[model samples]
Target: MNITLLEAELRRDEGTKYSPYIDSTGNQTIGVGRNMKANPIPKDWTFPLTDAQVNQLLAEDIQTACASLDRFLPWATAR
Candidate 1:
């Protein structure tokens, strides 16, 4: 998968958030759609996340999703 393209799409679709906010589903979200309920914010982090931090969270979330696919749907990622 072209992660760069994927990141761009996610940023465009989800938009960036420096501070936590309630999403449409009412989930506490921060960064680039980083669901705080599934993964709580790090204790070291503060309210306003920097661009670098948001990007980091985006990358981590993508990685976690990819890993889940690899484990549960190996055939889907065999490309």
Candidate 2:
């Protein structure tokens, strides 16, 4: 339940490129960027990202990838 760890995972997966902003009300907005600069914010959106939203997104990702760990370090666990 660490925010830093979740942020690290989000950063690793390029969360900034996807649902960048955590929104003012704990909601995620996708494809909010426009232009070569790859703006990470939406026009109608407001500032301030809540810890809940950011953590939620990262947590969901971690959950989805949980099964992928089985394939990792397989040789060591193989019997």
How close is every model to the real structure, measured as TM-score?
0.95, 0.33
Q: What shift in Å separates residue 59 of candidate 1 from its native position after superposition?
A: 0.7
For model 2 the TM-score comes to 0.33
- Cα lDDT, all candidates: 0.92, 0.46
Q: What is the overall TM-score of model 1 with all chains considered together? A: 0.95
By TM-score, who's the top model here? 1
* Model 2 weakest 10-residue run by lDDT: 31-40
For candidate 2, lDDT tens digit of each residue in 47-73?
444555445445555654454554775
- Candidate 2 RMSD to the real structure: 10.1
Summing lDDT over every window of 10 consecutive residues in candidate 1, give the lowest-scoring window.
39-48
lDDT per residue for candidate 1 within 7-69, as digits (tens), equals: 999999999999999999999999888899998878999979998889889999999999999
